[model samples]
Target: MDDSGLVSFFRVESCGLYRIRQKADGEFISDGFPEISKSLFDWLSDRSVLNTIPWDPKEHTRRDKVYCKDVHFDSYTGDYLFVLWFANSEAAGEVGEVGEVGGIDLNSKVGDTNNDSEKIDAKNSTGKELTIGKAMYYWFIPSLKLVASINFKHSKTDIEAFTTYIKKWFDNKNKHPNKT
Candidate 1:
């Protein structure tokens, strides 16, 4: 799979300041789900395959590159597929640009997190005990690195789960210099 294929499979939306077509706001996405649309949600609900995406733990070692030796490569969809987050993405206001891009979320604001699937202590059943914040991901494309900076107000566990998944998928494996 290539970059286009990754976007389609992952269904990544547009970059900052713009909303992608048929996107389900974070609220629409179930508690554990990263992001999905109403259609996807319905489909998954029907099949009862909500949490059945097959991905096992993978081990990866860092393969030094000629240009960016220190930068570690993340998950790959195929032999050449790469999910890159650039170092420049760490700079403020960088993701605020326009035009079609991959894996970028900027100026994200929190709306709601009460999707019913999220578990909360009944003592705080008023629901104030539970909340959600803006989750963001960016690819420092120029730097060929992917950076995710998602913050949460009360959904700490969800945030942790997401970050852990990303790190495991990328950090666990190293790119092979000589590909077959």
Candidate 2:
């Protein structure tokens, strides 16, 4: 659906109209438009970005509409690029826009059910302070980037697990050996 569920269509500046429909896996497909062969559909369907959002359908919404920062199709390479991020409802409110990154208020008294000071590692190998509360997932054709953060109040292990699940689908769209 076109963000509203009234109809489904994707239009590109160069490419003409495309009729899209959700597949059984909650991924979308262009129903044989522009006379692309069946093989192309298989390829496109296999690379769906939705596979990276690691929430269980039973626990979360069906995800007909995902929280996305940006989405676009590269005309030069014929690859689709998109960024999906999660800021928890309260964190989203802090940043104003869902697209903003890293305005997580560590001191905010929200979603802070677990406050274990012992688990604080100070920083990860990358030198960035290990944080909790906000997470982001990005997919660009064959590359998938996932970062899960934890604040002082959230469980580092649990957020790590969620990020791991998101990483599991990184190769969902690879045409060759998928990048790790």
Provide the TM-score for each candidate, comma-separated: 0.20, 0.26
**How many clashes does the backbone of model 2 have?**
6
**What is the C-alpha local distance difference test score of candidate 2?**
0.30
- Candidate 1 regions with alpha-carbon error over 4 angstroms: 1-49, 52-144, 157-180
Q: Model 1 — which ten-residue stretch has the worst lDDT? A: 63-72
Give per-residue CA lDDT, model 1, range 1-180, as digits (tens). Answer: 222211111222321222234665532212111221122223223221112121231322232110010112223421111111221222233222332111222111111122222222323343232222212222222222232332223111233433343433333321223211
After superposing candidate 2, which stretches have Cα over 4 Å from the reference?
Answer: 1-52, 57-70, 97-165, 168-180
